[model samples]
Every structure is written in structure tokens, then in C-alpha cells.
Target: MSKRKKAPSGNPANRGLSFVDRRIARDFERWLAASDTPLSDPHNAAGAVGHLFDITKRSGLDILEPSDTADIADMLLDIGPNATGMVDLFHDYVHFRLETSRDPRWHQAHDELEDVLDDDTGISAMLEAIITDAETRDPAVIADALAHTKVIDGVTKLLDWISTSRPITDTGALRLSDIEPAAAALGLRAAGARTLPATGDLHGQTAIADGITYVQSMWHLEPLAAWWRALLDTDVLELTASRVRPGRASQRWRTEPTPPLDVASEVVALVVSDTVLGDLPRPLRLGCFTLPGARHTCARGPHPRRRRQARTPHRDRRTIRPPCRTRLADARRSRPGRTDPQPPRHPIRRSRGLARRLCYRPARGPR
Candidate 1:
């Protein structure tokens, strides 16, 4: 007699008792029917279902199967509610799984779905998930994940959206404090040790400084343009196109035009008296003395001529006189008794009370 084959347990083709039984299928169908929106609603649960259907079709599945439900839900969640059919199917599958198995793995699977769907939705949702996950799991692990999120992009998008949708108001301005975390997250630093001012206090000076700081930290050239505009509105700085250094292409930079020598001298005097003294670099001091038509020559040590000039006192006009010219006959007639000694041979003049001869006589012999 031929050995009789034992009746296959459950459906032989399905391989043992499957989770996707008639009951589960019926439950899923009822959920799908009861859904308020159709399975094709663009913004509703239908998108999710459609995505799942596509995944199932691609997987070569003829009918809804037990093992494929969780994975299909995961895939639908990955693409998010944008895929209506996939989301719808996933929602039904989730409800069916919850009723049938009540397994803890269902909770994990659902969380994964939620994460993919809610990412980039908004800061509130992302922040809530981050804070919650941080509290429940290892803080470092959750922090790592949070750091990986496109937080800066989200913030910039939110700010832009708010600015566009809402009317402009004092409160709409982004405050330094409000953006501190985002700036830190983006690894941007303020240029120096100064803290950025609040939005309300951002005037020309502060705005220029902030722009410079941003450029310095991020190396982005865009902010520099804004900085130029801000500087133009303020007298504290001036922008000029100049050959900043020789042999380099000329460009605009903030600088002060040199004042006249007299005015600069006053300023220097005031600064020297009011400010704490420090050794000025030789080049800087030399730069300050660059006056037009004036020459600067280094003296070899101390000069005796300069010292003599400094010591000499200026003479009065009355103390200087030209020699007086007189004829010998006139001198004899004016002072006949006084010039009796050969008529003193030459006319004389008194200068600074000292008698000086006005005319010269040729030397005679060796006398």
C-alpha cells in the first residue's frame, strides 16, 4: 500500500498558520472602508496606502501577507504621507496588527513610521521628539541624532515662511538670543569676544560689526556687501576705493582721510596726554609724520649744529645795524678834535656798542 500523506497543516501553499488570515483581512478592509477620506485622498491616509500598494506590487506579492505588513508600513512611513495609498494601507495594517497580536514590536515599528513622517514637518514636532527621545534613551545617542538633523535649514525655512506669511512687526525680527542655538549648531562664531546685540539694538554700527563677524566666521562674501551698505550710512567709518597696498588690485575699504598737520598735531597731543602711554612702533610714528613737501632724514646720533641752533636766542632788529659811511673831510669837520690821530685811517660804525671799521685797507709789508 502507498504511504498516505498526512493532511497539510493550515493552507499548504501559505506555509503553516499565517497572520494574514481571513479575520485580519476582513478587519483591514473594514478599517479602509470606515476611513473618512477615500484611499486616494492626496492629503489624507490614502496616500500612505497607495505607497504601500506600490511597494507590495514591486515586491511581487499577490495579496496582503502577514510578514509584509510591518515592512510595507515602514516603507510608507519612509516616503511619508505624500504617498496617499501607502499611508492608508499602513494605517489599516497598524490597526489590524494592534488588534491581533498586540506585540511590543508593533510600537517600535509605529515609532519608526512616525519619525520618518514627522521629520522636517516643523521645529515643534522635531524638538518634542528630540527632547522626549533624549530623556528616554542614552542622552549622547539622542544628541548625536539631533545634531544630524538639518536644524539650521529648518530654522531658516521657518523664519522665511513666517516673514512672508505674517505682517512685519517689531517682534518679527530675529533676535540674537533667538538665533544663538541655531548659530552654535551651524558652528558659526561671532568675530571677536563681543556678544551680538539684540534685534532692537541693531543699528548701523552693530549691523556692520555683525556682518563682518559673520563673514570672518563663515568666510561667506555675501555679508560683506551688506556691511558696506551699513558702513556707508555711518560717519564712524568711511569707504573709499584705494590702492590699499602697492602692486595689488585696488578695492574699497573703510579708512579715515588724513587731517592737516596742525589739526593732527593737536589730536596727537591730546591723545598723548589722555591715554596711557605705550611704546609706539617706529614705523607707526614715522607714518604719522608723513607731511607733504617735508623730508625726513635720520640724523647720525646727536648733531652739534642742531644743538647750537636750539641753544641760540633770536636777535632784535634794533640790535642790528649797517656800518656808517663818512668822508674823511666830513669826519674831520664833525669831530676835528676827536679824529686827530691820522683820521683813524677808516670810517667806523657802532654796532651793539662795539666800534667796527666799515672800509678795508690793503695789507702793507708784514705788519
Candidate 2:
């Protein structure tokens, strides 16, 4: 699939000298002044802000208030209802302004003052949407969520390993197994660890290397771009990208200091979020809720929506949590393992459920 669709915003340089427009232009100038993308580039913030501003002017409103995110429904009605490239330009510009611009005036190429979205929901919703989109599995949405969990495991394991030790390969190239399967490998993390990079190659994920199923598997089973974007958002991870793979120009991620708590999100990719997940398959958003531990005994229960809870309640809090370290020898050595069998690992981040599943191990990251 094409990674993302970006629209062209009209000429920000052509904005009027009216007080509201000038204030917006000034904000765009300051925001663009600090941007990494040069002003000359069409993709840059200042270059495209004016395109949609013109649309707002045509609407007779000081600002452009989009009725829908994926498709600017209101704008399309004003023009024609066709999904033209020009419409795409407007859509892309909205997200571009929202993500790249520093101020709200520049966010939608408009003049009306509106507060930015609730930070927590905006961040978490974007995350869930991406992971759901990234999934390409045949089984169900749960499979995709499971695979994302594995990626988190892989990342956490790699961070713990590389920071405390040196790279296994002399040239600083870490293998795939080193990073994936991080949850299961915790027992072996101190003993034998696999340090794989974020791979763009799907075939390589399951292709055997060094006698393990790519150490931890399933991350590459989804769209490679999503996997790359998912973990890159956290500020804790400082990935030094390497191109050391034999055939592919894949990333060779190495360890940074163990991530400290409290990094929210990043916008490296122009993600196809900010829209309601109505564009995606229903299974991705609506899911089954089974008994926490009893897979064999229990039948698939009604999902969160069926229970009449608020929609997408999980996204309400987008907090970043650091991985907690367990000192088994000092604290739990005297205690014995429980006689009851351990429960299955929860795929997505259900902290309490995952705790029961990954009993006595580190938690999955800021899910």
C-alpha cells in the first residue's frame, strides 16, 4: 500500500493582509522558521497553508471547518462531490497543518480560533488507528494487536540488552532474534538475547536465521511502515539507524539508554489518523472480549461496544510508562512459583490482563 496520501495546501504566501489572516501568516512564519523541511519545499508548512485558506474564504467563513477528516465532505459539497486530487490536497493539508504547524491558526489553514484536540485522545487514537491499519493478517484484528505486542517485546528487550552490553556482531550489526520475542526472552534476556532491527522485509521475519524464528516473530507480518512508525513515536527510544542487512536496505536498530518514563508521541510519518476509524474494517475497531485466562472453557463474549461503554475509552489516557525492573533474586527468590498454570499472554495492552498472562515479568510498553 502507498504509505500515506498528502494534499496540497494553496499558496500560503498569497494570504491577505486582513488582521486574522496576517496573524495566521505570522504564526506560520514562526512555525516554519523552526521546521526541518525548507520553505522552498511544497511539503513544508508555509508552502501549502494558503491553498485551503482560499477554500475557507470561498466558504464565507473566516476558517475552513472540515466536516470529515478522511474526506473533507463539506468542502467537497461546495465544489463537486468527486474525490479529486484537489480534494486530496485539501485533506493532506489539514493533517499537515495539524501535525507540522505550531499554532492552531495554521492547523486548518483558517482564521477562526479553535482549541486543539484533547491531547490524550488525539495521541492514543492515532496510535490505535495506525496499528490497526498496519495489520495485514487474515485471522482477525486480535492477530494484529498480538503482533504489535511482540514488537513492543522486541523493542524493550533490545533496549535492556544493548545498553547493558556490547553488540554481538563486531561491526555493531544486531541480528533479528536479538530484538523480537522480548517477552518470552526475559528469562533468557540476561543469558541469551536476540537484537533485531525494525525490518521492512516481511519474508525475512519468518525465514530462519541463527536457529530461531527470527527470535521474536510477527512484527514484520504486518505492514513494515506501521511497525517502523509505531515504536519511533516514543521519545525514550533513540534508534541509530543502520543499513547492515545482507540483501535489503533494512534498518539495523541498536540500543540506547533504557527509556525513562513520560514521552507522549511523535509525528515522523504523516499518519492517516485524525479521522474516525469508520474508514477501517469494523473488526479492527470492534473486538471480542473473552474471559481473561480461560480460552478453552469460555466462548467469545460481547466486545466493549456491545457492553455499552464509551466508544474507544482506552484512548482517553495516553500516558507513557517506563518498563519496571524486577529484582527476583533479592525480593522473590524465597517465594516459590504458584502451582496453578499461567494464563495466556494478552495480545494488545491490557495491563492487568497482560500481568496475569506474562506473570512475574516486565509489562509491555505505553499501550
Best prediction by lDDT: 2
Give one digit per residue, the lDDT tens place, for model 2 in 1-367: 8777776554544545366665665465555555554453535545455645544454343342332221232333223223244444454446556775566544333221121111123234433444455434343444334434434335445444445433323322234444443323332221123444344222333333333333222232222223333333333233344422211111222322322221211111111110111111112211211112222112222222121132233422112111111112223222111111211111232222111121211222332
Query: Using Cα atoms with residue i matched to residue i, what is each candidate's TM-score against the true structure?
Result: 0.22, 0.22
Poorest 10 consecutive residues by lDDT, candidate 2: 270-279
Please give the lDDT score at residue 160 for candidate 1: 33
lDDT of 1 by residue, 206-304 (tens): 323434333211112212221211112211122223211111111111121222223222222222211111111211122322111011111111212
Stretch of 10 with least lDDT, candidate 1: 352-361
TM-score: model 2 vs. ground truth: 0.22
